[model samples]
Target chain A: MDQITLYTWIGFSVFLVLMLVVGYLSSKKMKSIRDFATGGGTLGPYVLGFSFAATYLSAATFLGYPGWSYEWGLSNLWLFLAIIAGGPIGVLMVAKKVRKLNNGQKSLSLPDWLGDFYKSDILRVGTGLILLFNIFYIAAQFVAGAKIFEYLLGMSYTSGLLLIALIVVIYVYAGGALADIYTDAVQAFIMAIAGIGIFISGIVIFWKGGISDTFAGISHELAAQNENLVAVFNPESLHFYSIGAVIGAIVIQWAFASAPHLFNKVLGLKNEQDLGKMIATYVVVAALSVLVLFGGLYSRAALGDTASAADLALMDYIIWAFPAIVVALFGVVILAAAMSTTDGIFVSISTVFANDIFLKFLVKRNIVKVSDEKAEKIAFQISRLTVPFIGLLALLIVIRPPEYMGDVMWIGISGIAAGTMGPILQAVYAKRKAPARAAELSMFVGLGSYLFLYFTGIIPSTMSAGAVSVFIGIATINIASWILRSASSSEMGAAEEGGS
Target chain B: INEMLSIWLYGFIIALIIIGFSLWKWYF
Candidate 1:
């Protein structure tokens, strides 16, 4: 084959081997579910930082974002800038207290942490079910990865999906949380390098133009068609969603640091010593996010008008705009971004199922008779084995993707945000003793209100249904807890940190 | 590169200010 193709395959093979080695090496420490789930609290700041950023970006950020930039023009760049809000949210809001509470708790999963925080299994299960919607989103990420492989490497989508599933399942099952974090760090570096490489190449390619030039061209083209391209909130333009979408985006992004999976990195932190460095890592990664986002705008300006297919502008930039070698390298980065995330999702889900469902449900009810040692072994075994099960489900769902899958994910995330954000934020931030029932009520009411308003179209056109759910969720928590915690101090326990 | 870096720097500066204020509230 061609030299570029040959080199790319070699590079891809090397990356795959490196991932396997990281997982295998980290597996040496995998004596139990702690290593499998939370790195036994050993991850350093840089690794956790990179891993968190990489996991957050996903294949969707790389693939779908440029298409948005292509269609919408410069105003879309604001959304990417909005992503940096995660840094402060991670440090001030989530990480410090999460790390503080986690001290001596030996908590391994989000469910365990939240359950213990509120001392409610009902809350645990409810939140766990809500988080399972993440599986659908993760499944979508896998589909996007398979599509990327199909686009770049000329692989059949079916073969790519199967191969991707097998690889993620293998490494993640073996490495557990340690494997996911380590491999994610490596994947983050690959993404950052590829992001910059693609950005610079986009600028140099065919001397097409800068951000200002691109917007000017868009204005020129639009003017000829009796339209404008760069307004902040253009409802009439097919090129842009309403300005309200940006508000919705900012809310979603600002809350993004609270995604329980992303919070997995916080749980993985070793101690308070690494906190500042970890936060700094997030800042650096956030800076890089701005750069990569700029690249999206660049690609739109450079190649928007000529491409027959608007959505594939990114792929075209790599293929026609850059050299074959750049294409091959970027191809590896794209697939790496996709696969590494699958590995993290796999470990997270497996941890939830084995620790949250199997152990919490079965052992607590005395459905299984086993020693603590035997129980830990069973959970570890379950965590590893559940990978194939999730893989199978995702594969099946992908094959016959629901018509409303995108909307389903949107509603599910809003429901989850409504249900969990209020409770979790209250648990961490508020000192007042909200009753356990407060968490349960808030989750259900939040989700219920979001779904009710959205399905009934009662939500105002100007307002976000998700934000409304959030407001309702917070109000539910405050009102319910105020009522419950007042005369029920015995049940509430009134303890801020550990179990009273 | 300068522009991208500046935006991030300013954004992070704002982040740090908020973080600083929050920490003060938590401790003081």
Candidate 2:
């Protein structure tokens, strides 16, 4: 429509080309399935660290969250704290153990890690089924990113979604984990700069020539409407201050430690020492990302509650206040967030299906009839082929997403956390192994109860289904483990010491 | 300005303390 909008599109097109170039460069020199899946376990701390951060903050953080934060004010900081702490804190607690286990198992994927740890092909298949929900997960990121483009170009939502999905599939399909990790590192840098730019832009809008300006605290319009808009905690809601909110934060954030796509970066580290450095780098970068979180506060302060969709709160403000190029670059930041997340999810899902489900579970007793090297070559090809196929599957599922998402999104997330976190923690920390059946039952009961209590409204929506599901899963697992105690401790040392 | 800043500052302090305690307990 305007010259600036045209310039914005030109910048985005250049950015997309740059990303494709990175994908091409990373795709070279892949000798094995290991390279495709885990970057051959040779990625350094910086690459893996930024990759973790980029994938951890998805399109939701970029788009949906700020608008939610805009309405709620400082209460939104609780969610912000969750985002900054989730991956860093999770890694600080568990990454060393993850790397050590990687050494013990040489796991190509999280499902592989779980299967080997529990020694159950059935559990691996179950984990794979749970992760298949990445179709929605990938689409969730796509939807968030597309919403920004939808606003920017004034196009149909479907067109933006299709454009993003195609870009994610192409790069990930071509370069695998190598491309994902490297591009994620670059995306993290871009996001940090974009976040700072947004914060400064918001701050400058309120600037005045004299000693003081009426726009001192939130927008003049918002503060005029309700002075509580500037209050630290609007005692009525007590959002960030509530006990349930804090606990909910912990439960959802713990999923960072449990998610396959997020932590699979750890499985790609060059060495244990690098893993420690990765934690520090990841934490610092992600924690500092709070700058972007302030964009919502700025948006609310700059342009108070509007009739626009809550997700568009910040973007709408940016569109009105900033030049077209700044808005367009911000769009790149959103795309980076979505693409970083989608690429990782793509790699995780495709590799899980190819490596864990097809090769390990379906190849007749985890053994293929060929030399180890030849089997690995076939596995590599299968994983590469599965990338596009997995992308297509995700594309198809996302084509007709549920109109009423209901509790399905949160339920699915909590189920994944409840299902995997309990079993994985025990495998790494428990002195004695729980029966595989107990592990399997924990997943089913966890996922099932989350949906059941969730759908039945047994647990109030105020309380997280994830936290409830996790406790239920733990309870069921503890009882099951105690009752079905095995006499032998043969699998006791799987992820713990003495496994080899 | 101070009130809004104080609230967010408190949230950040509390979150950092949690991380501090965790790092000490796990790594120290």
Kindly list the per-residue Cα lDDT of model 1 for residues A381-413, writing each as its tens digit.
Answer: 987777888888777767743322233334545
Give the C-alpha lDDT of model 1.
0.63
Docking category of candidate 1:
incorrect
Model 2 per-residue lDDT tens digits across residues A1-500: 36556766787788778766655655565445435545536678776777677765567666655655676665666666666566456667676666565565666566777787788887899988887766766666766766766777776677876877787787676553434556677777777666777767766776674323523545454567666655554444323445665566566676645543346667766555566677667766676665676677777766667726666777877777787777787777777667667776776677776678767876647455666677677778887887767766656655653321212234445657767776777676666777788888888888787768666766544226667777777777777876665323344533333232
Model 2, runs deviating above 4 Å: A25-44, A176-178, A207-216, A219-242, A258-274, A366-412, A455-463, A486-500, B1-7, B17-28
Q: Give the Cα lDDT of each candidate.
A: 0.63, 0.65
What does candidate 2 score on TM? 0.82
* lDDT, model 1, position A3: 60
Quote each prediction's TM-score.
Answer: 0.79, 0.82
Q: What is the TM-score of chain A in candidate 1?
A: 0.81
Following a full C-alpha superposition, what root-mean-square deviation does model 1 have from the true structure?
5.3
